[model samples]
Target: MLFGAKNSSNPRLQLLKDVVLFKDLSMRELAMVDSLMHERRYLADEIIFDEGEEGQGLFVVLSGRVKIARFASPLEMLIELGPGAFFGEVALLDQSVRSAQARALEDVQIAVLFRAEFYSLLETHSAIASRISFQLARVLAARLRQAVANTDRHHEAA
Candidate 1:
């Protein structure tokens, strides 16, 4: 199979199911999303995407770990994500510059859902697109709330 056989046991399909963006998708829907995705392997310390680069799309860690970092004066490391975690979701909405860079902490396998491919899927499957878009919004909202809470705590501590 060109994109891996469409079977219940397909690891890629399972990985897609575990991601927040595709969590609501059924097995059949996962297969459709899988079709739009391409796999890439990166070695430890390899850059996946750099901050300020044009955002490509969402990247899900299929295996190993990925580090999301902000390259400021001190180079702050933001988060380390393992299998099934996803990043660069903002690119799905528009091809803006990335705010952070992603690197492989170890040899990693990633599934990339490119913007053009996602748009094509949206046109062909609006229902699926709507579901994913809504989920993305919810995820962002939750993160925003957490950020606000942290800011409030920081202010109180000062």
Candidate 2:
């Protein structure tokens, strides 16, 4: 019901509406966010962004899969994302370098929301921005908790 009474058009809009970070956004607010989006495609195995590179914004997976991995001493894999998933959101709040590398697991399509545009939305649409920011904070906190739990388990095993 959040994406508009279900229609043939706006599949991308519907998909984004279901995504966690965008769920609280209304259809109109989503359209405003959509206006700032630009689509890009990548082939399997292509590097979408490299670890240590500057993160410009959030990358929403529209189609296909993405593999997020790190290049540290252990070279760990962070996550694999599919349609309706998003990453690089921290960059929207803090323009920091990426902590992991993103690669296309297959031919993929993504919608990119640039940082400047996101900030502009935050200024002009505070309500929508607050919803998204709250969601982002929740996700970050959950990830932090998971990491701590994993570390505790590792120590116990050791």
| Best candidate, TM-score | 1
Relative to the true structure, how large is the alpha-carbon lDDT of every model? 0.91, 0.89
Q: Each model's TM-score, in the order given?
A: 0.93, 0.89
Predicted candidate 1 versus true structure: per-residue lDDT over 116-139, tens digit per residue: 998998899988888989999999
Cα shift from native, residue 84, model 2 (Å): 0.9
Using alpha carbons, what is the TM-score of model 2?
0.89
Report how far residue 101 has shifted in candidate 1, in Å.
1.1
In model 2, which runs have C-alpha deviations exceeding 4 angstroms?
A: 1-9, 73-75
lDDT of 2 at 122: 86
Candidate 1, position 98, lDDT: 97
Candidate 2 shows a clash count of: 0
